[model samples]
Target: MRLPIPTLALIASILSVVTAKSSTGDRVLVVLESGIEKGDYSKFWKSLEARGYSLTFKSPKDDTAELIKYGERKYDHLIMYAPGQKTFSPALSPQSILHAQLDGLNTLYLLSPSLSPLNRDTFREYDLEFTDSSAGNTLISPFSSLASDPSSPLIFPAHSPLLSSSPANPVLSPSTLSGGPIVFPEAISHFAGETPYGFPILGAPRGSYVGGSGGNSNSTAGEGRKGGEVVLAGKMAGVVSAFQTRDNVRIGFVGSGKALSDKVWEASVEDQEGVTHRTANAAFAQDLTSWVFQETGVLRVECATHWSKTGGEVEKAEYRKNEEVAYSVSITQYSPSSGTYIPLVTPPSDLQLEFTMLDPFVRTPLILNSTASSAQGSTTYSASFRAPDRHGVFKFVVEYWRPGYTYLRSSTTTAVVPLRHDEHKRFITGAYPFYGATVSVSVAFVLFCGMWLGMGEERGRKKAE
Candidate 1:
């Protein structure tokens, strides 16, 4: 009797699963507070689990709440689901989040529908402000599908490559949307103060104000009245705000949690051409996750320059033909975690150098000479080559471009020319025949003049006699 295909598939699947688990170690730690609804995250958690991550959930009330634990050590990620308590202490405060980040842990924090009494001093320390105001409200634009159906409790604006399609634009045409969720705050503001590392993720619709009673108020009110109107009648808007601290810690502020609801997570938006589609919250969530996970591309050096050791104090503006010179270059890489710059190296080695003019004259692989104090960590390329005999404005150039690394470009020009006034050989062996001919002519003339004088004297004596 032949075995059933289902049984055979099940065995194969189990074997594959075992093999995957043995090779991969991925885990997540979710910290949810009391009373917050677990909406689309449930689906997301399942997806993560399916991707071979072990998901663990905890609350601030748990005995181990203060401790972030993983398989052998601590969690690789921390998901904060809006704590309702008054204050998150140092052990549970935002500093804890920073600590986790310092340890290379990724974090995601969601905004709560209701404001918690917790004083976000830590966030304030980073120049972020969260507030509650009656003046804050969402607006539906004629451009959005939500505007067409005011009664639709769950409305998705449009599909965005940067965001999932379920949540579409409510004001601009869905086609104009690039990111997910235009978060309009009833009243919210973030001031960067001395440091402006915080980048705005969304802005208010055109002609929107942040304060006031949200009614018709002219601009020419009394001084006190104007101030009051500005404070109380202006509109507030922000979809998501993010900041990177001097220490390289990133924090994102979300104004509305309803946008990430379970139903919205499953909703998708179709492109205008109808060629592509994306879920509203899914795309946004994916992008946000990628950013928080530090997977986004960071800074890279595009280029650099270096001078030669013997290029003189002025750095040799030009080079002459047959002149020998040396040059070096340095390229670097950017690290988002430490927010520091690091030097780049060749594959089998740490650094490389080149000597070039128009085309590379010398392509030499450099080896780090730690024994040499001048080149301890640096790779030096040194060589002596005569400039091409051709006379022209030629440059000594080194151009280096590495993937995910800074680019290096360096050049020095030396004007090479045919032998100069003092450069030519004083006497030419090939002109010996011409030199001898000229000398012989001068001697013959001198001899002829002397003989003519003697002949004159002799003729005078004969006349006297």
Candidate 2:
């Protein structure tokens, strides 16, 4: 039997609420390598589904898996797990992927040691340079590896120095950081250039090095030679990295696909010291996906207002020079658990505001308004300062950039006009001296003229006598 119209509408609303997981959108495209089964990373897939994402799996050879259509993104996010595949669909080309990201599609890229030239060039565009694959470069660490075999995978212990993180980094939550070690197999070392948009998520251990011979070698990266040279060592090596465009498009690069495999998620790792540790791969994978999918570290400016403190006027089109002004902006951060934007209780201490013309005239920190923030599910940051003495078209700009978080930028423009003639002071203390001098000069000139006329009259009377 056909459902009633009202019932159908109700069902559709429920479905919409259920699928709204990501702050951006819920549509995800998973591009898999040929012959790879979906069950290979079942846990990862399930987690995405649980979070309400609608995933579409496609092979690299599938022509129908287009990321863009009619100059718009078909999917909100793209997951390319087909590492080491030499060929890809034309719609998924490197340039195409880059353009899709520009169109606001977040992406995740899993890579292998053997990178095709196309992949290399693509990553290079993001300032990520991997070790030379032709030289048989493999990341090896005797102390961190499971065994003496050069082919053995490496393990990062709890709070491993190799896993670089910051409190501000949303990619690794506090629980994940304090959790079990991560098992990294078939690790390919790479280097990240100095780019503000990109940063390394995982660094190589102190003694780890990438060289041609994947064997136990004591030589550092500088001393390696012969058939294979060490291309990266220590902190210079990175296994995982991330890039976020200015438009808030996020991209993640994992050097090894096995790291996200179900087998690795359940596997335990033992270092050379014979200490066994549970794998945090599952947690790491979730966090990575959560971030790239815009489920975490997402921020939105709800509203911003500026007004003259003295006049109590808000959102005026123009402001007078030297007026005390107050600016406040409401910001909300996306919460995956609630599936909504919530107040940012603890905003960054460095959140700042700048009043700018050609250059910044006023720069100050934006303080949190606790009462206002608690009322709504958003944080309100406000700053009060005197408008610059110089008058011109000025902008109230707030630029908050932190790694693993969305770049927050808000700019509001208003003209700062010179004071009106009636607004000018009737008397200026600094001009008192000039005023007194003018009056004295006038009086002296009048007395001189009177004396000259009196002398001329006396001379004329003497001549008549």
Each prediction's RMSD over C-alphas, in Å, is 12.9, 7.2
Worst 10 residues of 2 by lDDT: 157-166
Off by over 4 Å in 1: 1-27, 47-54, 67-73, 117-119, 134-145, 148-194, 207-236, 266-279, 299-465
- What 10-residue stretch in candidate 1 is worst by lDDT? 147-156
Candidate 1 structure quality by residue, lDDT tens digits, 1-465: 888999999887755443332011245667666765565457766545543457678765555655345523366656676634566545556666666666555556665525464634555665655544343323222122232321111222332222331132111233334444332212233333333555544433333333333334433322334323332121233445565544444555654454455555645543223323344555555445445444332323333333334565344555556666444443333333233444433322434444445665556554433343144333344334555567665555554432211224455555556667887788899999999999999999999999999999999999999
What lDDT score belongs to each candidate, Candidate 1 first?
0.46, 0.81
lDDT of 2 by residue, 1-465 (tens): 999999999887766546558888989999988756789889888877866989998888788888899887899999998766778888887778888999999999987776777777788989999887444666776567665444345544344332444455677877777787676777787899989998777776677777745344444434557435666777788888899999999999987777887887857766778877778888888888889999888998998899989876557888999989999999999887667888874587778999999899999999988898888768998999999999899999999887888999999999999999899999899999999999999999999999999999999999999
lDDT of 1 at 142: 18
> How far off is residue 72 in model 2, in Å?
3.0
Candidate 1 Cα deviation (angstroms), residue 22: 19
Q: RMSD of candidate 1 to the true fold? A: 12.9
